[model samples]
Target: MEYRKIFYNVSEKDMSFEDVIDRLKTFITADPRSEYVLSVGTDSHVHAKDTKFITAIHLHRKGKGAWGCLQNTFINRQINSIHEKISIETSLSQEVAYHFTSDYLVELSELLIPFSDEGADLTFEIHLDIGRKGVTKDLIQEMTGRVLAMGVEAKIKPDSYTAFGYANRYTR
Candidate 1:
Protein backbone atom coordinates (compact mmCIF):
# COMPACT_ATOMS: atom_id res chain seq x y z
CA MET A 1 0.00 0.00 0.00
CA GLU A 2 1.07 3.56 -0.68
CA TYR A 3 -0.16 6.99 0.37
CA ARG A 4 0.29 10.42 -1.17
CA LYS A 5 -0.75 13.88 0.00
CA ILE A 6 -0.90 17.22 -1.78
CA PHE A 7 -1.30 20.73 -0.41
CA TYR A 8 -2.34 23.91 -2.18
CA ASN A 9 -2.16 27.35 -0.68
CA VAL A 10 -5.16 28.67 -2.51
CA SER A 11 -5.57 32.40 -2.89
CA GLU A 12 -9.00 32.61 -1.31
CA LYS A 13 -9.60 35.95 -2.94
CA ASP A 14 -9.22 34.57 -6.46
CA MET A 15 -9.89 30.82 -6.48
CA SER A 16 -13.11 28.99 -5.74
CA PHE A 17 -13.75 25.37 -4.87
CA GLU A 18 -14.50 24.66 -8.53
CA ASP A 19 -11.04 25.79 -9.52
CA VAL A 20 -9.49 23.49 -6.96
CA ILE A 21 -11.52 20.56 -8.28
CA ASP A 22 -10.36 21.21 -11.83
CA ARG A 23 -6.74 21.21 -10.78
CA LEU A 24 -7.27 18.02 -8.79
CA LYS A 25 -8.77 16.25 -11.81
CA THR A 26 -5.81 17.26 -13.88
CA PHE A 27 -3.42 15.96 -11.24
CA ILE A 28 -5.17 12.63 -10.99
CA THR A 29 -5.53 12.04 -14.73
CA ALA A 30 -1.92 12.85 -15.38
CA ASP A 31 -0.94 9.75 -13.49
CA PRO A 32 -1.07 6.27 -15.08
CA ARG A 33 -2.52 4.32 -12.15
CA SER A 34 -6.15 3.22 -12.52
CA GLU A 35 -7.05 2.99 -8.82
CA TYR A 36 -6.83 5.44 -5.90
CA VAL A 37 -8.71 6.93 -2.94
CA LEU A 38 -8.71 10.70 -2.40
CA SER A 39 -9.67 12.75 0.68
CA VAL A 40 -9.85 16.53 0.54
CA GLY A 41 -9.62 18.88 3.53
CA THR A 42 -10.84 22.44 3.94
CA ASP A 43 -10.64 24.53 7.10
CA SER A 44 -13.66 26.19 8.68
CA HIS A 45 -12.37 29.52 9.90
CA VAL A 46 -14.09 31.03 12.90
CA HIS A 47 -13.59 34.67 12.09
CA ALA A 48 -13.91 34.78 8.32
CA LYS A 49 -16.45 33.34 5.89
CA ASP A 50 -15.41 29.82 4.86
CA THR A 51 -12.68 30.10 2.26
CA LYS A 52 -13.12 26.58 0.87
CA PHE A 53 -9.48 25.78 0.17
CA ILE A 54 -8.65 22.07 0.18
CA THR A 55 -6.02 19.42 0.76
CA ALA A 56 -6.43 16.09 -1.05
CA ILE A 57 -4.85 12.74 -0.15
CA HIS A 58 -4.85 9.49 -2.09
CA LEU A 59 -4.35 5.94 -0.88
CA HIS A 60 -3.41 3.03 -3.10
CA ARG A 61 -3.48 -0.61 -2.17
CA LYS A 62 -3.47 -3.98 -3.88
CA GLY A 63 -5.14 -7.33 -3.34
CA LYS A 64 -6.41 -9.08 -0.18
CA GLY A 65 -4.92 -6.83 2.47
CA ALA A 66 -5.94 -3.48 0.99
CA TRP A 67 -8.39 -2.38 3.65
CA GLY A 68 -5.77 -2.35 6.38
CA CYS A 69 -3.55 -0.19 4.26
CA LEU A 70 -6.36 2.23 3.53
CA GLN A 71 -7.17 2.54 7.21
CA ASN A 72 -3.60 3.25 8.12
CA THR A 73 -3.31 5.88 5.46
CA PHE A 74 -6.42 7.59 6.77
CA ILE A 75 -5.09 7.56 10.30
CA ASN A 76 -1.81 9.11 9.30
CA ARG A 77 -3.62 12.09 7.82
CA GLN A 78 -6.25 12.61 10.46
CA ILE A 79 -6.76 16.12 11.75
CA ASN A 80 -8.36 17.45 14.95
CA SER A 81 -11.18 19.84 14.28
CA ILE A 82 -13.00 21.87 16.87
CA HIS A 83 -16.28 21.80 14.98
CA GLU A 84 -15.97 18.42 13.29
CA LYS A 85 -14.84 14.96 14.16
CA ILE A 86 -12.83 12.57 11.99
CA SER A 87 -14.07 9.05 12.40
CA ILE A 88 -13.46 5.79 10.62
CA GLU A 89 -16.68 3.98 9.85
CA THR A 90 -15.84 0.44 8.89
CA SER A 91 -17.91 -1.92 6.75
CA LEU A 92 -19.21 -3.65 9.87
CA SER A 93 -20.54 -0.34 11.28
CA GLN A 94 -17.69 0.03 13.73
CA GLU A 95 -16.46 3.55 14.22
CA VAL A 96 -13.15 4.77 15.62
CA ALA A 97 -12.81 8.42 16.48
CA TYR A 98 -9.75 10.50 17.21
CA HIS A 99 -8.77 14.08 17.91
CA PHE A 100 -5.82 15.78 16.23
CA THR A 101 -4.03 19.09 16.53
CA SER A 102 -4.73 21.87 14.05
CA ASP A 103 -1.34 21.75 12.33
CA TYR A 104 -2.04 18.29 10.91
CA LEU A 105 -4.50 19.62 8.35
CA VAL A 106 -1.71 20.99 6.21
CA GLU A 107 0.27 17.83 6.69
CA LEU A 108 -2.66 15.75 5.53
CA SER A 109 -3.39 17.94 2.54
CA GLU A 110 0.21 17.72 1.41
CA LEU A 111 -0.08 13.96 1.25
CA LEU A 112 -2.43 13.69 -1.77
CA ILE A 113 -0.68 11.91 -4.62
CA PRO A 114 -0.56 8.77 -6.79
CA PHE A 115 0.22 5.50 -5.07
CA SER A 116 0.99 3.80 -8.36
CA ASP A 117 2.16 0.41 -7.10
CA GLU A 118 -0.78 -0.52 -4.85
CA GLY A 119 -2.83 -2.09 -7.70
CA ALA A 120 -6.26 -1.64 -6.12
CA ASP A 121 -9.47 -0.02 -7.38
CA LEU A 122 -9.65 3.78 -7.18
CA THR A 123 -12.26 5.88 -5.38
CA PHE A 124 -12.43 9.53 -4.35
CA GLU A 125 -14.38 11.79 -2.00
CA ILE A 126 -13.99 15.56 -1.80
CA HIS A 127 -14.98 17.57 1.29
CA LEU A 128 -15.51 21.27 0.75
CA ASP A 129 -17.82 24.01 1.98
CA ILE A 130 -19.25 26.36 -0.62
CA GLY A 131 -20.15 29.62 1.07
CA ARG A 132 -22.22 31.55 -1.47
CA LYS A 133 -24.98 30.60 -3.92
CA GLY A 134 -23.58 32.31 -7.01
CA VAL A 135 -20.13 30.85 -6.49
CA THR A 136 -21.66 27.45 -5.88
CA LYS A 137 -23.39 27.55 -9.25
CA ASP A 138 -20.17 28.43 -11.03
CA LEU A 139 -18.31 25.74 -9.14
CA ILE A 140 -20.87 23.15 -10.16
CA GLN A 141 -20.60 24.12 -13.81
CA GLU A 142 -16.84 23.78 -13.77
CA MET A 143 -17.01 20.48 -11.88
CA THR A 144 -19.49 19.12 -14.43
CA GLY A 145 -17.16 19.94 -17.29
CA ARG A 146 -14.15 18.28 -15.67
CA VAL A 147 -16.02 15.14 -14.70
CA LEU A 148 -17.43 14.78 -18.20
CA ALA A 149 -14.00 15.25 -19.72
CA MET A 150 -12.62 12.49 -17.51
CA GLY A 151 -15.41 10.12 -18.63
CA VAL A 152 -16.09 9.09 -15.07
CA GLU A 153 -19.62 8.76 -13.72
CA ALA A 154 -20.36 10.98 -10.69
CA LYS A 155 -23.25 12.11 -8.52
CA ILE A 156 -23.48 15.79 -7.64
CA LYS A 157 -25.42 17.15 -4.68
CA PRO A 158 -26.61 20.71 -4.11
CA ASP A 159 -27.69 22.42 -0.89
CA SER A 160 -31.43 22.31 -1.64
CA TYR A 161 -33.81 19.68 -2.96
CA THR A 162 -35.18 21.49 -6.03
CA ALA A 163 -32.16 23.37 -7.33
CA PHE A 164 -30.43 20.73 -9.45
CA GLY A 165 -31.20 17.06 -9.34
CA TYR A 166 -28.04 14.94 -9.60
CA ALA A 167 -26.57 16.62 -12.67
CA ASN A 168 -23.69 14.16 -12.86
CA ARG A 169 -25.93 11.10 -12.83
CA TYR A 170 -27.85 12.08 -15.98
CA THR A 171 -26.15 13.71 -18.90
CA ARG A 172 -27.96 16.39 -20.87
Candidate 2:
Protein backbone atom coordinates (compact mmCIF):
# COMPACT_ATOMS: atom_id res chain seq x y z
CA MET A 1 0.00 0.00 0.00
CA GLU A 2 1.13 3.52 -0.66
CA TYR A 3 2.16 5.64 2.30
CA ARG A 4 -0.36 8.44 2.51
CA LYS A 5 1.65 11.23 4.05
CA ILE A 6 -0.27 14.44 4.51
CA PHE A 7 1.04 17.89 5.24
CA TYR A 8 -1.04 20.77 6.53
CA ASN A 9 -1.76 22.10 3.04
CA VAL A 10 -0.54 19.25 0.87
CA SER A 11 -0.28 15.50 0.60
CA GLU A 12 3.08 13.82 0.21
CA LYS A 13 1.53 10.52 -0.72
CA ASP A 14 4.02 7.98 -2.03
CA MET A 15 6.93 10.40 -1.80
CA SER A 16 10.33 8.83 -1.12
CA PHE A 17 12.32 9.52 2.04
CA GLU A 18 14.70 11.72 0.08
CA ASP A 19 11.77 13.68 -1.27
CA VAL A 20 10.51 14.17 2.27
CA ILE A 21 13.91 15.50 3.26
CA ASP A 22 13.84 17.97 0.38
CA ARG A 23 10.32 19.13 1.15
CA LEU A 24 11.27 19.60 4.82
CA LYS A 25 14.20 21.72 3.76
CA THR A 26 11.87 23.87 1.72
CA PHE A 27 9.51 24.17 4.68
CA ILE A 28 12.31 25.30 7.01
CA THR A 29 13.67 27.87 4.59
CA ALA A 30 10.19 29.22 4.01
CA ASP A 31 10.54 30.85 7.41
CA PRO A 32 14.07 32.21 7.40
CA ARG A 33 14.21 33.70 10.86
CA SER A 34 11.86 31.39 12.70
CA GLU A 35 13.06 28.93 15.34
CA TYR A 36 12.08 25.34 14.60
CA VAL A 37 11.05 22.28 16.56
CA LEU A 38 10.61 18.99 14.74
CA SER A 39 8.49 16.30 16.29
CA VAL A 40 7.27 12.75 15.65
CA GLY A 41 4.22 11.18 17.27
CA THR A 42 1.64 8.44 16.85
CA ASP A 43 -1.99 7.85 17.85
CA SER A 44 -4.05 4.68 17.59
CA HIS A 45 -7.69 3.69 17.75
CA VAL A 46 -9.08 0.20 17.96
CA HIS A 47 -12.03 -0.19 15.59
CA ALA A 48 -14.03 -3.31 14.96
CA LYS A 49 -11.44 -6.11 14.98
CA ASP A 50 -8.46 -4.01 14.08
CA THR A 51 -6.39 -1.05 15.23
CA LYS A 52 -5.71 2.01 13.14
CA PHE A 53 -2.43 3.77 13.77
CA ILE A 54 -1.33 7.15 12.50
CA THR A 55 2.20 8.46 12.85
CA ALA A 56 2.99 12.10 12.17
CA ILE A 57 6.09 14.24 11.67
CA HIS A 58 5.68 17.92 12.39
CA LEU A 59 7.71 21.06 11.90
CA HIS A 60 6.78 23.92 14.19
CA ARG A 61 8.11 27.33 13.33
CA LYS A 62 7.84 28.74 16.82
CA GLY A 63 5.38 31.65 16.66
CA LYS A 64 4.79 31.22 12.94
CA GLY A 65 2.82 28.72 10.91
CA ALA A 66 3.72 25.01 10.83
CA TRP A 67 3.29 21.93 8.65
CA GLY A 68 3.94 18.19 8.80
CA CYS A 69 3.33 14.76 7.31
CA LEU A 70 1.53 11.61 8.41
CA GLN A 71 1.52 7.90 7.66
CA ASN A 72 -1.14 5.43 8.75
CA THR A 73 -1.46 1.67 8.98
CA PHE A 74 -4.05 -0.83 10.05
CA ILE A 75 -3.27 -3.82 12.23
CA ASN A 76 -5.36 -6.93 12.31
CA ARG A 77 -4.62 -7.86 15.91
CA GLN A 78 -7.25 -7.15 18.53
CA ILE A 79 -5.43 -5.33 21.31
CA ASN A 80 -7.48 -5.38 24.52
CA SER A 81 -5.18 -3.78 27.04
CA ILE A 82 -4.60 -0.06 27.49
CA HIS A 83 -0.96 -0.67 28.35
CA GLU A 84 -0.40 -2.53 25.12
CA LYS A 85 -2.14 0.18 23.12
CA ILE A 86 -0.19 3.05 24.64
CA SER A 87 3.10 1.18 24.50
CA ILE A 88 2.67 0.46 20.81
CA GLU A 89 1.77 4.09 20.15
CA THR A 90 4.91 5.30 21.89
CA SER A 91 7.00 2.80 19.95
CA LEU A 92 5.64 3.99 16.65
CA SER A 93 6.52 7.59 17.42
CA GLN A 94 9.95 6.57 18.62
CA GLU A 95 10.53 4.61 15.44
CA VAL A 96 9.84 7.68 13.34
CA ALA A 97 12.12 9.87 15.47
CA TYR A 98 14.82 7.23 15.29
CA HIS A 99 14.66 7.24 11.53
CA PHE A 100 14.64 11.01 11.35
CA THR A 101 17.91 11.14 13.21
CA SER A 102 19.65 8.11 11.77
CA ASP A 103 18.52 8.11 8.17
CA TYR A 104 18.24 11.84 7.54
CA LEU A 105 20.24 13.60 10.21
CA VAL A 106 23.12 14.60 7.97
CA GLU A 107 20.78 16.14 5.45
CA LEU A 108 18.47 17.62 8.06
CA SER A 109 21.36 18.96 10.09
CA GLU A 110 22.83 20.64 7.04
CA LEU A 111 19.51 22.30 6.38
CA LEU A 112 18.90 23.27 10.00
CA ILE A 113 22.29 24.44 11.23
CA PRO A 114 22.14 27.75 9.48
CA PHE A 115 18.99 28.62 11.37
CA SER A 116 20.48 27.28 14.59
CA ASP A 117 23.59 29.41 14.17
CA GLU A 118 21.35 32.40 13.72
CA GLY A 119 20.00 31.77 17.26
CA ALA A 120 17.17 29.44 16.34
CA ASP A 121 17.32 26.17 18.22
CA LEU A 122 16.44 23.27 15.93
CA THR A 123 15.38 20.53 18.31
CA PHE A 124 13.66 17.21 17.73
CA GLU A 125 10.98 15.65 19.91
CA ILE A 126 8.95 12.48 20.36
CA HIS A 127 5.36 13.03 21.51
CA LEU A 128 3.80 10.49 23.82
CA ASP A 129 0.05 10.30 24.37
CA ILE A 130 0.36 9.39 28.06
CA GLY A 131 -0.58 11.93 30.71
CA ARG A 132 -0.32 12.31 34.48
CA LYS A 133 -4.04 12.29 35.21
CA GLY A 134 -4.87 9.00 33.53
CA VAL A 135 -4.09 5.30 33.50
CA THR A 136 -1.16 6.13 31.27
CA LYS A 137 0.52 8.04 34.10
CA ASP A 138 2.46 4.99 35.17
CA LEU A 139 4.04 4.56 31.77
CA ILE A 140 5.34 8.12 31.53
CA GLN A 141 8.69 7.32 33.08
CA GLU A 142 9.32 4.33 30.84
CA MET A 143 8.11 5.98 27.66
CA THR A 144 10.00 9.20 28.20
CA GLY A 145 13.08 7.24 29.14
CA ARG A 146 12.92 5.29 25.90
CA VAL A 147 12.68 8.50 23.88
CA LEU A 148 15.44 10.23 25.81
CA ALA A 149 17.64 7.17 25.42
CA MET A 150 17.21 7.54 21.69
CA GLY A 151 18.74 11.02 22.01
CA VAL A 152 15.58 13.08 21.44
CA GLU A 153 13.31 14.86 23.85
CA ALA A 154 9.85 13.59 24.76
CA LYS A 155 6.58 15.41 25.50
CA ILE A 156 3.50 13.89 27.06
CA LYS A 157 -0.19 14.71 27.25
CA PRO A 158 -1.32 18.31 27.61
CA ASP A 159 1.90 19.27 25.90
CA SER A 160 2.02 16.71 23.09
CA TYR A 161 -0.30 18.02 20.44
CA THR A 162 1.43 16.10 17.70
CA ALA A 163 0.29 12.85 19.28
CA PHE A 164 -3.15 13.82 20.55
CA GLY A 165 -3.92 16.56 18.06
CA TYR A 166 -2.48 15.84 14.62
CA ALA A 167 -2.00 12.07 14.69
CA ASN A 168 -5.32 11.55 16.42
CA ARG A 169 -7.23 13.07 13.53
CA TYR A 170 -6.39 10.17 11.24
CA THR A 171 -6.63 7.32 13.71
CA ARG A 172 -10.20 6.87 12.71
Candidate 3:
Protein backbone atom coordinates (compact mmCIF):
# COMPACT_ATOMS: atom_id res chain seq x y z
CA MET A 1 0.00 0.00 0.00
CA GLU A 2 2.97 2.30 0.54
CA TYR A 3 4.01 4.12 -2.65
CA ARG A 4 6.86 6.46 -3.53
CA LYS A 5 6.53 9.46 -5.85
CA ILE A 6 9.67 10.32 -7.78
CA PHE A 7 9.96 13.29 -10.17
CA TYR A 8 12.49 14.28 -12.84
CA ASN A 9 13.07 16.72 -15.71
CA VAL A 10 14.28 16.31 -19.27
CA SER A 11 14.46 18.02 -22.65
CA GLU A 12 11.39 18.57 -24.87
CA LYS A 13 12.66 18.31 -28.44
CA ASP A 14 11.59 15.44 -30.71
CA MET A 15 10.23 13.66 -27.66
CA SER A 16 6.70 12.54 -26.97
CA PHE A 17 4.81 10.75 -24.23
CA GLU A 18 4.76 7.62 -26.34
CA ASP A 19 8.54 7.55 -26.31
CA VAL A 20 8.55 7.56 -22.54
CA ILE A 21 5.99 4.79 -22.37
CA ASP A 22 7.96 2.71 -24.82
CA ARG A 23 11.06 3.05 -22.70
CA LEU A 24 9.12 2.03 -19.59
CA LYS A 25 7.72 -0.98 -21.34
CA THR A 26 11.19 -2.03 -22.33
CA PHE A 27 12.34 -1.54 -18.76
CA ILE A 28 9.59 -3.74 -17.35
CA THR A 29 10.18 -6.44 -19.89
CA ALA A 30 13.87 -6.62 -19.05
CA ASP A 31 13.36 -6.77 -15.31
CA PRO A 32 12.67 -10.05 -13.57
CA ARG A 33 10.54 -8.44 -10.88
CA SER A 34 7.29 -8.47 -12.75
CA GLU A 35 4.90 -6.61 -10.47
CA TYR A 36 5.09 -2.93 -11.25
CA VAL A 37 3.19 -0.15 -13.00
CA LEU A 38 4.56 2.70 -15.12
CA SER A 39 2.72 5.96 -15.76
CA VAL A 40 3.69 8.91 -17.94
CA GLY A 41 2.01 12.32 -17.93
CA THR A 42 2.80 14.38 -20.99
CA ASP A 43 2.02 17.83 -22.29
CA SER A 44 -0.56 18.41 -25.01
CA HIS A 45 2.09 18.56 -27.72
CA VAL A 46 2.57 14.79 -28.00
CA HIS A 47 -1.05 13.72 -27.79
CA ALA A 48 -1.45 12.53 -31.36
CA LYS A 49 1.12 9.82 -32.11
CA ASP A 50 -1.10 7.74 -34.37
CA THR A 51 -0.50 4.61 -32.42
CA LYS A 52 -2.66 2.19 -30.44
CA PHE A 53 -0.83 2.36 -27.17
CA ILE A 54 -1.83 1.04 -23.76
CA THR A 55 -2.66 3.66 -21.20
CA ALA A 56 -1.36 1.68 -18.21
CA ILE A 57 1.04 -1.12 -17.48
CA HIS A 58 0.78 -3.85 -14.83
CA LEU A 59 3.87 -5.66 -13.69
CA HIS A 60 3.23 -8.90 -11.82
CA ARG A 61 6.29 -10.53 -10.40
CA LYS A 62 5.70 -13.49 -8.11
CA GLY A 63 2.69 -12.55 -5.96
CA LYS A 64 3.17 -8.79 -5.98
CA GLY A 65 1.52 -6.44 -8.44
CA ALA A 66 2.41 -2.88 -9.33
CA TRP A 67 -0.05 -0.68 -11.19
CA GLY A 68 1.05 2.31 -13.21
CA CYS A 69 -1.43 4.99 -14.22
CA LEU A 70 -0.37 6.87 -17.36
CA GLN A 71 -2.30 10.03 -16.81
CA ASN A 72 -2.57 12.67 -19.56
CA THR A 73 -4.82 15.09 -17.78
CA PHE A 74 -4.41 16.79 -14.41
CA ILE A 75 -7.40 19.10 -14.25
CA ASN A 76 -8.57 20.71 -11.01
CA ARG A 77 -11.24 18.09 -10.42
CA GLN A 78 -8.80 15.18 -10.53
CA ILE A 79 -6.29 16.89 -8.28
CA ASN A 80 -8.97 17.69 -5.74
CA SER A 81 -10.12 14.09 -5.60
CA ILE A 82 -6.59 12.78 -5.05
CA HIS A 83 -5.80 15.47 -2.50
CA GLU A 84 -8.92 14.59 -0.56
CA LYS A 85 -7.94 10.94 -0.50
CA ILE A 86 -4.09 10.75 -0.37
CA SER A 87 -2.70 14.23 0.42
CA ILE A 88 -0.08 13.83 -2.31
CA GLU A 89 -0.16 15.40 -5.75
CA THR A 90 2.31 14.45 -8.50
CA SER A 91 2.56 17.05 -11.20
CA LEU A 92 4.18 16.03 -14.46
CA SER A 93 3.37 19.27 -16.20
CA GLN A 94 1.35 22.36 -15.50
CA GLU A 95 -1.53 20.70 -17.31
CA VAL A 96 -0.93 17.08 -16.29
CA ALA A 97 -0.59 15.80 -12.73
CA TYR A 98 -1.71 12.84 -10.64
CA HIS A 99 -2.59 12.28 -7.00
CA PHE A 100 -1.98 8.98 -5.28
CA THR A 101 -2.59 7.84 -1.73
CA SER A 102 -1.71 4.71 0.17
CA ASP A 103 -5.18 3.27 -0.30
CA TYR A 104 -5.36 4.03 -4.00
CA LEU A 105 -1.85 2.81 -4.62
CA VAL A 106 -2.72 -0.42 -2.86
CA GLU A 107 -5.77 -0.77 -5.02
CA LEU A 108 -3.69 -0.16 -8.11
CA SER A 109 -1.14 -2.71 -7.01
CA GLU A 110 -3.86 -5.27 -6.50
CA LEU A 111 -5.37 -4.59 -9.90
CA LEU A 112 -2.05 -5.21 -11.66
CA ILE A 113 -1.01 -8.38 -9.82
CA PRO A 114 -3.10 -10.71 -11.96
CA PHE A 115 -1.53 -9.46 -15.17
CA SER A 116 1.89 -10.62 -14.08
CA ASP A 117 0.68 -14.14 -13.41
CA GLU A 118 -0.74 -14.38 -16.88
CA GLY A 119 2.48 -13.14 -18.52
CA ALA A 120 0.84 -9.80 -19.16
CA ASP A 121 3.04 -7.86 -16.77
CA LEU A 122 3.50 -4.83 -18.99
CA THR A 123 0.61 -2.49 -19.73
CA PHE A 124 0.42 0.46 -22.09
CA GLU A 125 1.56 3.81 -20.71
CA ILE A 126 -0.29 7.14 -21.26
CA HIS A 127 1.10 10.24 -22.90
CA LEU A 128 0.10 13.84 -22.06
CA ASP A 129 2.50 16.19 -23.82
CA ILE A 130 0.35 18.92 -25.34
CA GLY A 131 3.14 20.79 -27.15
CA ARG A 132 2.22 24.21 -25.87
CA LYS A 133 4.16 27.01 -24.29
CA GLY A 134 3.11 29.33 -21.42
CA VAL A 135 2.47 26.40 -19.07
CA THR A 136 4.85 27.91 -16.58
CA LYS A 137 5.55 27.75 -12.86
CA ASP A 138 2.98 30.43 -12.21
CA LEU A 139 0.32 28.22 -13.68
CA ILE A 140 1.47 25.31 -11.55
CA GLN A 141 1.52 27.50 -8.48
CA GLU A 142 -1.98 28.60 -9.23
CA MET A 143 -3.07 25.00 -9.59
CA THR A 144 -1.32 24.06 -6.36
CA GLY A 145 -2.97 26.94 -4.60
CA ARG A 146 -6.34 25.72 -5.76
CA VAL A 147 -5.64 22.22 -4.49
CA LEU A 148 -4.46 23.60 -1.17
CA ALA A 149 -7.60 25.67 -0.98
CA MET A 150 -9.47 22.39 -1.06
CA GLY A 151 -7.41 21.18 1.93
CA VAL A 152 -5.22 18.90 -0.18
CA GLU A 153 -1.47 18.51 -0.46
CA ALA A 154 -0.22 19.61 -3.87
CA LYS A 155 3.12 20.41 -5.50
CA ILE A 156 4.37 21.31 -8.99
CA LYS A 157 7.43 20.38 -11.05
CA PRO A 158 8.78 21.68 -14.33
CA ASP A 159 7.10 20.11 -17.34
CA SER A 160 10.40 19.60 -19.17
CA TYR A 161 11.68 17.22 -16.53
CA THR A 162 8.50 15.18 -16.43
CA ALA A 163 8.49 14.63 -20.16
CA PHE A 164 12.10 13.70 -20.83
CA GLY A 165 13.54 12.31 -17.59
CA TYR A 166 13.77 8.79 -18.91
CA ALA A 167 16.07 9.70 -21.79
CA ASN A 168 18.23 12.04 -19.76
CA ARG A 169 18.41 9.69 -16.78
CA TYR A 170 18.46 12.65 -14.44
CA THR A 171 17.51 11.90 -10.86
CA ARG A 172 14.78 14.01 -9.36
Mind giving the per-residue lDDT tens digits that candidate 1 earns over 5-77?
Answer: 2222322233333343454455444543445443322222222322221222223232321111011112233
What order do candidates take by TM-score, descending?
Answer: 2, 3, 1
* True-structure Cα RMSD, model 2: 3.3
For every candidate in turn, the CA RMSD to the true structure comes to: 17.0, 3.3, 13.6
Q: Please name the candidate that would achieve the greatest lDDT relative to the true structure.
A: 2
Taking all chains together, each candidate's TM-score versus the true structure is 0.25, 0.87, 0.26
User: lDDT order of candidates, best first?
Assistant: 2, 3, 1
Candidate 2 off by > 4 Å = 1-10, 112-118
lDDT of 3 at 74: 28
Q: Judged by TM-score relative to the true structure, which candidate is superior, 1 or 2?
A: 2
- What is the clash tally of candidate 2? 0
Backbone clashes for every candidate come to: 12, 0, 24
> Global lDDT of each model?
0.29, 0.79, 0.33
